[model samples]
Target chain A: MSSKKQASSQLRVGDNPLVKWLLVGLTLFLTAILLVVPLIAIFQQAFVEGAAHYFNSLLEADTLHAIGLTLLVAALTVPVNLVFGVMLAWSVTRFEFPGRKLLMTLMDIPFAVSPVVAGLLYLLLYGNNGWIGAWLYEQDIQLMFAWPGIVMVTVFVTCPFVARELIPLMQQQGREDEEAAVILGASGWQLFRRVTLPNIKWALIYGVILTNARAVGEFGAVSVVSGNIRGETNTLPLHVQLQYEDYQAAAAFASASLLAFIALLTLLFKAFIEWRQERQEATL
Target chain B: MSILIEHISKTFGQFQALSPLSLDIQEGEMIGLLGPSGSGKTTLLRIIAGLEGADTGRIQFGDRDVTNLHVRDRRVGFVFQNYALFRHMTVADNVAFGLDVLPRKERPSPSEIKKRVMHLLDMVQLAHLANRFPSQLSGGQKQRIALARALATQPEVLLLDEPFGALDAKVRKELRRWLRGLHEELGFTSVFVTHDQEEALELSDRVVVMSNGYIEQVDKPGDLYASPNSRFVFDFLGNANVFEGKADQGKWLNQQASLQLPKGIEQQDGQLYVRSHEFFVSDAPTEQANLPLKVVAINPIGAEVRLELSPIGWQSKDIWEIDLPHKAFDQHGYEKGQTVFVTPKAGYFFADDLAQPTPLHW
Candidate 1:
């Protein structure tokens, strides 16, 4: 016991300069090999054929169509998720009801399941030979191997983002302020619009950013559901895969670089938001 | 307007929060619900504010039944213990919230709202900090803003649940005086809940003493203190010394002490309750003396000295606390371990013991 106490007392930062330097060196070495090297390689490969060739490759009809389709899919998915997230979070946090824990667990199911499994689940429910698919086919409505299928898979993969961001925040805020508003003669909708919405706006924006990023970058689920149809169902990530398969290395790297750029932009935006939130909270 | 509560009772699952209770407040009266924690004071206050519905009750605001009305329509301003001010809004905006959230047809224009908010801020002495957020204000300032916001709608009745319970000692005293003054000038009927006996007695026109989900007594502060109706009220309202003894004929006797009972008292197990200041200590034993006690501890509070006394050679659980004024303490020169005979100047007795009482004063 005395020896343990002595060891704990001696365990201060910078106690062993050599060990600290070794750990720092190891961390940098691993980060360079794992992250920095691959990022540099992707940019290098994309620009190998020159900037003109790279820009031309991206301006191709099928690639432009894919980019437009990805944007369309994100546009449809992110808003739906945003609305659903706010409603679910509000209901779960503000009210007492039976099966609340079960509802929260169900909301988290998509996050726990593999993306490929999520895609396959949707496929089994909406594929041509599937139950719903056959009925829709009789009505001349095509859902499988189409843009709708791609959008559905993307929504499933990104559905939990906004609600996950908001549930804890609304719960922490509690019902006191809203109750105070109600007692102050604010109507139901007015309480929500004036009091609740402003409080959760930051978390809502953060959730939307995450959901949009996931919807734009989703590959596994969209591939399984979209059936890899070039220019029609292929999103940006799928287009990159198709370009690589055709042995067009320059085209593939150019498309991949676009995704990398988006991801980087998302990181920067998230960091800026987090910094702003921290400053606001400090004043609070 | 006066408020009336009739047969109000509440139960959460199997726990009985409040038994059948009724209270009436005259117009412009400042009443306090005084009790310890879980005594249903807050629950009763919330029911009055229309925030929580009583299981079986009818509430009326000057004969207009408000039992079924929503909180917004109740027009009763409520100040919570935590202040509940909107953190994102400035003090002026928070005060203006009630006016801003009114229905479009009833809503005031923006400039009118600013003027009314500024006026209320000035009333609360927060006009200088109107631009500051609640997070930037001290606890007292935040509570003042809460009070200003609650009053912005000109509520007929105001309800506060431990309004000063969250503040420190000095701030609480100052705000208590300020609130009393505000209520007098505004002429709004208000009910506040608090566990601090001093706060309740100091600020209230009348106090409702409650215990175990039941109303013990309701009276003016001086009356409640001088003549408590139950053993619970006697103990809860002030410092008390309890002595357990058996009533035999016209005398109450126990293993360590005996006292002359009031005339014609029944023979039964009884407990005598004496307020700390109601006892006198004498150096010489007299006929009125009940027991010789050794002073175990002496605590000199601000204006009075509290003496903890135990009967000499007594192994029973009874220990008497005698409070003497500083002048009396100086004259008697009582010290720790000094022996003195104790006699009750005034006391009350419950013939059925402390648990369930049958009051017989002596």
Candidate 2:
């Protein structure tokens, strides 16, 4: 009986090596074709004109403004979304109430809908002759083709990032630590700042990073809202499109490479953060 | 301080988590709420800690009516089963959390907070690890830090919900003893929830045995052990050899065995529960020997030998286990497949409170 048990319990190697190798080969092949190829092509095209030309294109006044506008939009959108996301996640995950599922589904709307649809939805709400837009326009507030419009669309596109990252994590963490803090004489805000915030900080950062990336790189939505006004409301992705349309191929790829670099950095940071978290958990 | 819970009750949707129950915990008393998982022990603890509000109840902490107070305002310290320490905070910061969160006017100075935190860490014997985050601490160390944090605010009452439930057996035993010592030193009114009857009995000034959202009994360990009020308490507190039989005119008889009842005992159908150690075994069947049993298995566990027996005219269902001292076993020369007559040394008979026979499955 013991020998049979030991025999069954012994760790078995791959039962079918062919299937294992096939799976590995297929994954690597698909990854190379889909992800690696596009990444390499962007850099290849950007530097096809010498490094000096690529740098000169990057330093162009319009390109600089587009980069600045993208950064400003991301800077503004990320913080707003970060606050809203934390509040949304906290309310949904920590409290039990009627219509919580409905609220959660609403939060996920930005993720489910196309960015173009999201921009259109905001436009309907705030465009000239639109619902709230008509009243706002009568009050002399320009929103449809301006910076605020760009920001509004960015916010809508990135709304679910932080909350989506945090909700499941906070839910899994449960209410014990918060309850303990409360019992230990922590006020509501103190409980949140001390206990809840620290627990969800890493997830919050991960969410913010993704949200910032999306806000900077958002194309379809920002395009629908911004009117593609150069040096004014054109974000980096829209700027890339404008350059491409104007036959400024070197400039477009150079700009594209910048966004791609940001995406790569975000991916690397995310991987590092996850690795660190895993290491910490392993030590624990 | 003493806590008065008046007719406390709670329900989660259709499930009643706590029935209308009242308990008075005196100042400096360490009370154990002992029960199975669904028995509302943890719920009651949470209610007292003001972490959960009772649907209908008035709670008084000393002279103050704290039933309507927020958990923070109630000045109750709570320790959770999972240790619930702030994962990102070091041991010192965790211990200082309660004090640091106090309103600015009431908050201690930074140096004062540091001193107090270190003092608490020293008390828990974790001062050496004060810089370590909760994740770096062992389960036992984390729990001790939790206790220290809960105590930092000088709460009027301390409540723990299965505080050591996440720990291994050896660590649990060590922490239970440590908690007992700490409770004695601090002299705070405390109530802890635990399902382990031995833990409750060993560590509590008094144990409140609960079942199905009702308090079954409350007594000192010795008293509760000797005099369990209900069948649930009797079964939950310790192991028992339960015999179901009908008493008739100073004698009791079941399908497979007969025993003489003590004189003047009422004639009634009931179950008799005897602790294993309360049964005597002998080689010969005398008048005092009530049941003739055939020993089927002898399990030696430390100083005692547990004899698994079947009645002489055994049906498949008729089996009894009795524990004898190893010396007694040796003296009697008892072995498997040998005949021995057994009699109850001490036991309890509950009228009409028969234990349901456990079905045997192969």
Candidate 3:
């Protein structure tokens, strides 16, 4: 009976190793096919013609303008989102006030709403004869088919990223440290700049990375409000779509490759920031 | 400076954290608020430090009413239980935080702040750790750094809540002695809150035993220990043998047992009390005072042997404890379940009047 029990235990333990390896192999296979294969395909397509052609086409005026506009949007949206996101996070976590729950739910609305709905909502509010747009149009002020319209859409799309990242972190941190600072005679501004800022610095950085990535990659929202004006409102993602529609295969793939490269860099940055934060929290 | 606390009360929702309590703290005295958890020791200390506000009361610190004052404006130093050292700052910077908060007109120069920080660090014997962050230090080191930080501002009063509560046994013992020495050297008016009876007994100039948001007794360490004003203080301070017998005129009687009442216990009910070490074995009855007893358990604890005796006259499991020296036990050769007569030491008073239980544990 003992030998039979030992044999069954041995079989059970032996079966797990094979199962574990099989699961690991399955994961690797899927990752290779889904992510790596597409990346390799894009790289192959970019260099199919020639490195010289790829390099020459990258510096084209249209491509340059599209890249510039995408960069401009990311730069504009990230800092504003960073500040507002931190303030909202602070309010939700540090202060108790009326309508706190409502404010929190409102902050998360952008995350749950579809990007298409977001763009459509902006159009309804800011279009030529819609809501406040008619009054602006009477004064010859244009929002739709403009950079301001594109920026507004990008901000709306990326707004929740920073605050979402910070809220949970600030909540976990509580108000003990800030209270300690206050009791130690630190002024309100000094308490924020010193005690509050340093603690949430990494989370804020992570949020900014997520915001900038989304802002750069935003296509649905920008496409609707930008009116797809060539060389003017044509951001990189929109430019890639335009190139694809125009049947400029190589150029389309080339710009798509650039967008993918930027995304890859952002992902790598996000990973690094997360790793550092984990290390800091472990030490704490 | 005298601190007069008048009917201070703090209530959180339906639960009363501190009731209408009044106390007076004399200047240059190290007072200990001794109690168990949730006994309002910490709440009282925080109220004194201006970290907490009493719902209905006034607090006078040296003729200046500080009931509504902010913690910083109270000019009081508070050392928290977990040390609460700011992790981002170096030891010197942590100590210098309060000093640096001074207005620019009254702020000390860089050299003076450095010198003072170093001086405080040296006082805590942690000058070597001045450059290290709080994360790099051990629990004991962190506590010392906290003490130094609290002392940096040179406040009028110092408050410590469970100063050694987070430390290990050996470190806590060493720091207890070290803290006593520092308190003596500093000569600051300090009030420390602790649940450890041994800590309060060993360190305080005056120990105030608190229970259920009220002060049970306040006296010097030796006086409180020798004659605890309540049963809670007695049990909390040390072990004792309590006999619940009534003193009728000059004799005490309960059930079928009877013994002569001591001098001070003539007028009290439940009037028999004896310290563990006060009882002694006697084969024959003593002329004036004696009791017949049976040894039920012999518990030897290091150099002292605690003998538990069952009452011979009383028909119950009422056990009395007697602590004899190891040599005395060896000389007597007493065994468990042995019967003998014992006489309590002379002048041992009946403590029935002070045997009321307080709602505090140690």
> Which tens-of-lDDT digit does each residue in B1-362 have in candidate 3?
56788999987678788889888888888999999898899999888887778899999998898888887678777888877777788889999988888778878999999999999999999999999988889999999998888888887688898999999989999998998888788878889999999899898999999888888899999988766767667657755666666667676566656556544433556545567777667776665344667888888897899888888766433468888999888898987777777666632343455545322110
Alpha-carbon deviation at B120 in model 2, angstroms = 2.6
The candidate scoring highest on DockQ is 2
Measured by TM-score, the strongest candidate is 1
Q: Of 1 and 3, which scores higher on lDDT?
A: 1
TM-score sort, best first: 1, 2, 3
What lDDT score belongs to each candidate, Candidate 1 first? 0.89, 0.87, 0.83
| Tens digits of per-residue lDDT for model 2, A1-284 | 99988876673666466888899999999999999999999999999998999999999999999999999999999999999999999899888999999999998888899989988888889999789999999999989889899999889889999999999999999998888888778887888787888788889989998998898889988899898889898889999999999999988999999999999999999998899878877876
Error of 3 at A54 (Å): 2.8
Q: Which ten residues in a row have the lowest lDDT in candidate 3 chain A?
A: A175-184
Candidate 2 lDDT by residue in tens digits, B171-193? 99999999999898889999999
Tell me which of candidates 1 and 2 scores higher on TM-score: 1
Arrange candidates, best DockQ first: 2, 1, 3
What proportion of the real contacts between chains A and B does each prediction keep?
Answer: 0.87, 0.98, 0.23
The 10 consecutive residues of candidate 3 chain B with the worst lDDT sum are B353-362
Model 2 lDDT on a 0 to 1 scale:
0.87
Docking class of 3: acceptable
Per-residue lDDT of candidate 1, residues A128-220 (tens digit): 788898788888888879999999989999999999999999998888999899999998998988889989989999999999999999998
In TM-score terms, candidate 1 sits at: 0.92
Chain B TM-score list for all models? 0.93, 0.91, 0.85
